[model samples]
Every structure is written in C-alpha cells, then in structure tokens.
Target: MQQACTGDRFFTFYLLDGFALHGFSAAVEALRLANDVAGRPVYDWLAVTADGQPAVSSCGMRIAADRSLAEERDRLLRVAPPRCIVVCGGRMAPPPDRALEAWLRLCGRNRLALGSFASGLYPLARAGLTDGRRCAVHWEHFPDFSERFFTAKARQTAFEIDGSLYTCAGGNAPFDLFLRLIEADLGTDTVNRICEIALRERLRETGERQRLPLQARLGTDNAFLIRVIEQMEANLSEPLRLTALSPASGLSRRQMERLFRREMGRTPARYYLDLRLERAHLLLLTASQPIIEIAMACGFSTASHFSRTYRERYGCTPQQTRLAETARRRAGGRGNAPEMEHERHVA
Candidate 1:
C-alpha cells in the first residue's frame, strides 16, 4: 500500500456500458467536493473506456471517456501509474472484451490496486481477480455470481476491502467507499466537510450492513419466530430436524409448530422445507451447479425428492429453470426464473 501523502493521487475509472450512473456520480463527486473544500486538488480522476468512445449508462446517459484502454496502457509504461483503477458496471453489463480483460491482467502484473462497483465485480471475477477474495455484490446478483464463481467469497455488505482490492454493492455505496478512502488519505475532518457539502446526514461506515434485517422486512416482532427462521437460514445445507430445534430455540416441538402456524400460516416442517427449496431454486438459476449437487446442497436426501418438491412449489423442474435462465442470458433479457423479491436489499 502507498503511504498517504499531501500530493494528489490519480484515479482512473473504467466505465462499462450500462454502468450505474449514480455510482459513477457518487465516486467522482466526493473527490470533487474534497478538492473544492481543500481549495486544492487532493485527488485527480480520469474516465476511460475500452475504445475511448462514449459509454452509455443504465439510465440512458452517455459518458465520454478521457482516454482509451490502449492509450492508458501505453501511458502506464511511461509515467507514474494511477493510484487506483475502478471498474464501474451496469446491471446488464456484458462479459468483458478480451482486450479489456488482458488490460486488467496487465494492471495486476504491474501491481496496481484494482477495485469494482456494482456489477463491475462480474468482470473482475470473470477475469479471475476476485478468486479467494471477499467481495460485496448487490443482493440481486448474488445468486448468479455465487453460481458462476464458486471460488470467490461473496458478501451482502455495503462494501469490502481485501488487500488492495475494493468493491461495493453499487448505488451510493461508491460514496461510502470513496469517503473512506478520502478519510484515510486526508483526514476525518476533510471527509466530514465533504459529507456536509454533499448534504449527507451521516457517513455510513463500511462495516454497516447493506441488507435490512429479516424481522424488519417481514414486519414482525416475534423474537422467537425470528430466531427460528434465522436458524433455519443458517442451516439450509443441513436442515435441522423439528425435534432438534427445540433446544436451539428453548421451545418444545409443539410450541414451535404453533408459532410458525400462527405467524407464517405454515407448519414448521413445511416452512423449513420451503426454505431449502427456495435456496435450491436460486442456485439453479444463478449458478451452473448440477441439479444433483444443488439437491445435496439443499439437504434433500435424493435428487428425485428435490425435483418433486421443486415441481410442487414452482411448477417446473430445476433443469427447466436453469435452461430458461441460460436462454434469457443468451437473449439479453431478464431471466425467467422467479426471484425472492422481498429478500433483496438496496446497496
């Protein structure tokens, strides 16, 4: 890591087509505000693209790059390289071009720190940069990312910093990340001033959770029920028997069943089964794992049983769901697989 200095640090943002506009604005705006308040250039940034042409954002805004990938690559060989390079991507970002992927590999070889925002992590992961690293990805993309990159550790946090690699779940998360970076490079006073100028009420720490708690989302105050559901979520790969949950919840089997029936309108066993099946469904759509492996991961004793339960709930076989997802990706449309919409949390 480079020592924090009073001199300006250069940053390069690689914007991909369909990149989130808010994420780009938040990052650059923070640095812009920091320089404004300091009355000097504490940070410098350049926007770049693969071919040096304008990139279109998800919201249909066009952004012109300051340079092309080739130009930046040549410049890196001649001058002091950027302190950091961040890839900003959109929801439907396509797989990176081979030229861009090779350029990222060159950056890695030069020991330049790299980072990503939103679905930009997808390209980094595809380029093998995120392997064995903890990355924060939007909840909407977690399933697909996990399925595609089994070796990478994905977290549902606001942002993550592993070594020189930084990533965030997108939206205003880039603001939090950039603020933290500004604080580390300058000081808390500068960060606070920038936040005030930006009209932010509070600066969210990187450790703050990105997802709302399930209890709050469900609008329930039943602590016991919440605990039971948490346990079930934690034990999805190896479901607990109803009798075993008694000790964990400090409630008898009958009591737990009654609570589940009253609160969720389902038996405890049925609810647990549904949880596992739902997990399996997500794995089917998001990951390329085999049906049998997904079945085992979901704690089903056999693939037949998993398929039977899946068919009953979703009215389609797991293979059919995977195929549909594959077709959707090929067609450039949102996948046909059903998502647990309520489970999603904004970045």
Candidate 2:
C-alpha cells in the first residue's frame, strides 16, 4: 500500500441493486492499479448503496457499501463531497428510487462531475442530469433508452465524455474510460503503466466503435456486396431498384443477385425486403411515429402492406409489436423480446 498523494481525488460509486459486476470491477480495478503503479494513492474510492447494506450484482455477487445515501445526505453540508460520483447500473435494477433521484439532483445542483456505468444512464436521465447531453449505454439498451428519454442523446459508441458528464457502454469499456481519466489526472506515463499491468493491448479512445464491424462480423471481404448493403441501409426511405444498384455496384443485376445468393444465402430482393422490415421494426419500437408514417419511411407502398409484411416476418403485426413493447415496458422489462426470426439481413 502506498501513501496518499497531495492532490488525491475521491470517487463514490453508488451501487444500484443488481449492478453490472464486470463494469464495476473494471472501473474500480483501473483506479486501484493506478494507485499501485504511482507509488501513492492518486485516487481514493468508496462503494455506496441506497441503504446501509450490501447490494447484489447481476451475477449474484455482493459488494458491501461503506455508507448509505441517507448517511451521505445527512453529512452533505458537514463534509466535502467526492470529486466524482458514479452509478453502477444493470439489467435487473428495480424501479427508480425517488430518494436516489433526489440525491442525483442535489449532486447536479452542486455542479459536481457525474458518471454512469452501463445502464446507469437510465437513472441519470430520469434525474434530469443527462438532458441534452450525449451519453453511452449498452447497445442492447439503446433502443429502449431512446424511446423513454427523448431529451438525452443516446449514442452507440463505447463511451462519451461531455464536460462534467461521463458515460460508458457497460463491460470492459469502463477500463478504457478509467484509463482516460487517469491519463488526464496523472499523465500518459501512468496510464500506460496501468494498461500494461492490466494486460490491455491498447486503449480505445472515446467515440471509437463498441460493436464489431460488418465485414468482421460476417467473415467476408466482398467489397461489392458490402457496398450494395451499405446502399440499402442508406436508402431505407427510398429503396433503389436493382438496375440503379447495378450501375453503382459495377455489377450487372444478374451478377449482384448471384453474389447476394452466395454471400448472404438469400436473393437480393428477399434480402432487401428483410432489411427494410428490420428498420421498420426498430422504428416501431423506438419512435412514436404513426404506423402509416413508419410505413412510408420504410418505403412501403401502404400501411397495410407494411403491416402484412411485418406479420409474415415477425409472426406479429406492426401494431402488435408496438403493443408488446409497451406491455413489456409497463411490466418493467427494459429489453425487447428476442426476435422470432434471426436477422440475417443485418449489415
């Protein structure tokens, strides 16, 4: 153990019930490693919960808290507050606690820096701290988060740092976020040492991709096929005819169809139809647009046609899908039900 640095920073991690273990561990471990390598306590931290008791993680592991939100609130005017406060979020977090929301608002009024790990953005957004700010959440939660909180800009990147707000897509991404903070506070040399000790090959910068690329995901290097898919994705509202795509792809219509069959295991037209349907499905779940407007946005000739095709593909009508999503939300399930059909057309 090393002595404390003159300018030691204090961090408080508020563990919501069922918090993500990987994100919490990654963040705390990064700070711990920084202290070990610096030969001084450059950072100090304490785990906190809503009540003065241990909180269970999503994986069923438990972490004891040093204090409760009530205790901290009572001492708010007496002791200096931590420099940063982080909320550890998970899939199974219970309904938003009003007490927690109030505390977050108090933190915001004090102008203290705040952060969220994984799905913690939900609570932060509910507390109105993330309004109009870009934040990162796990990709699985992106659609639901966007639908619920229209004011916050939900990005799909690995992490985001907008002034006093910090957010990271949960998992190992927090390690990268903590490294960035360490670099800013201590320097690149200390960050490098921490990364080396943690066996991290490289530090992913903010705004870098969190998900795999299309080519890597599909295990193919077909440039023409990739370009055609890109075109389909870009022209969702105005689908291009095969003839129009042929000239752009440098392949004749027949050649493109044959290539789509070989690479995607489906004909070009069928693949394109599935692509549009997937976009429509996402819009139905995440946007409040009317069904007819969604149909037009997805290039459907009419709302009935869109609903018919959606039923055939998803085993439910578009209205039904929307209803199911609403029911799931009302029931407190934060994620969409698994798609009945595997999305083979996703680029």
Best-fitting candidate, scored by TM-score: 1
**Candidate 1 — which pairs collide?**
147-287
Report the C-alpha lDDT of model 1 over 1-347, residue by residue, as the tens digit: 11222437878889887688899889988888888888887788877888887776665556767788898889889888898999998665356478878888888888999999888888788888899998998875675687678898898888998888999989898999989888898899998898888889888876567888998876898988888888998888889888878778888888998999998999999999998898888777645557998898889989899999999999999989988766655533434333221111111
lDDT of each: 0.80, 0.80
Q: Write the per-residue lDDT of candidate 2 for residues 1-347, one digit (tens) a residue.
A: 11122337878888887688899889888988988898977788777788767776665556777778888777666777788899998653246779988998999999989999877787799899989998986765665576578899889899999999999988889999989998998899999888889888999988888888878966888999988888987787789998899989999999998999999999988999998898788767655667987798788988888988899999999999989866754543434333221111100
Per-residue error for 276 in candidate 1, Å, reads 4.0
- After superposition, candidate 2 runs with Cα above 4 Å error: 1-7, 91-94, 231-253, 268-347
